[model samples]
Target: MRKNPVATKAPAEQVVKDIRRAMRKLHSSEEKIRIVLSGLRGEDSIAELCRKEGIAQSLYYSWSKDFLEAGKKRLAGDTARQASTGEV
Candidate 1:
């Protein structure tokens, strides 16, 4: 009996890595803000939300922290302004 040549399997590590890579989603700033806000709403547990979003809890926390910090700085009028150059 002849064996099938196309029945080979990839390495476990490589398969896992590929899945992780494929699972990564690129979100825009608006989408990120929406996600963070949803987490803050507390309608569901953080773990559940993370699972639904396919993201880690740590990532959600990081985004929340950055969003709050930016708001704080903006409220404090700490925004950066570009310097105007005068022609000589």
Candidate 2:
């Protein structure tokens, strides 16, 4: 049997709360991607990060892809609505 690491088991509620706090400050999809990666770095586990963030591995991967592509494709797409309506 594999032994579970003492530090590896994370409470679901705690993870959700932590992710929520990170989410509140993130306004753009780009920012969300950054926060998710930061969370992954802190935990260093995709499964663990997915569990805490209340999202599936697919979503995380999808978002990560968007984030990396954000540098080139994000600004114009990100501000379109705001610029059009003058919301930003």
Candidate 3:
């Protein structure tokens, strides 16, 4: 008789990966900005802040980079608008 592959339980590693993926946290834009701003304040070491926030240093750095780039783009847009208004 042929065995049913689908009826069998998943492998331990696959089960663990599935659980982790399901349990992953989703951060809101506001939450991300707050965290980035906190890191920028320099009240605590980046490593310490990450540890307290229950996140990795790489994740913190990624958020920080995104936040700064967005601000820079917004400021540039504002400046261009101001110059155009002045010309008119």
Candidate 4:
């Protein structure tokens, strides 16, 4: 294990910013879906993905539910509009 000198420690503000940057990279539903899907393809384990991405499995499930619900709503809206407008 490598140890850093206490005198050369990074500032708290910089540490916080770096942590936020890492999270921000995975801060979108599309990104989450891609990560989850890629994991499904055996590139990595779901637990590993969650760990590396700094997310909980529950959060991943919630995002999946939200994505499915959003797609359903969009499809329903499109169907209603097409029925009213006779737009096939």
Candidate 3: Cα lDDT at 52:
92
* C-alpha lDDT of candidate 4 relative to the true structure: 0.72
The list of candidate 4 runs beyond 4 A from truth reads 1-26, 39-44, 78-88
lDDT of 2 by residue, 1-88 (tens): 7777655656766799898888863347655666567765775688877776667788777777776676556655754333545654
TM-scores, each model vs. reference: 0.66, 0.45, 0.75, 0.44
Which of the two candidates, 1 or 3, achieves a greater TM-score against the reference?
3
Runs in model 2 deviating more than 4 A are 1-31, 39-42, 73-82
lDDT of 3 by residue, 40-83 (tens): 99999999999998889999999999988888988788544444
Local accuracy of candidate 1 as per-residue lDDT tens digits, 1-88: 7666455444666789999899889989998998899999999998998999888899999999999999999999999867768632
Ranking by lDDT: 1, 3, 4, 2
After best superposition, candidate 1 residue 51: deviation in angstroms?
0.9
Task: Point to the candidate with the largest lDDT.
Answer: 1
lDDT by candidate, in order shown: 0.88, 0.68, 0.87, 0.72
**Clash pairs for candidate 2:** none
Q: Which 10 successive residues of model 2 have the least lDDT summed?
A: 79-88
Query: Of the candidates shown, which would achieve the greatest TM-score relative to the real structure?
Result: 3
Clash pairs detected, candidate 4: none
Q: Which prediction has more favorable TM-score, 1 or 4? A: 1
| Backbone clashes in model 3, listed as residue pairs | none
Clash number for model 1? 0
**Residue 83 alpha-carbon offset, candidate 1, angstroms:** 9.1
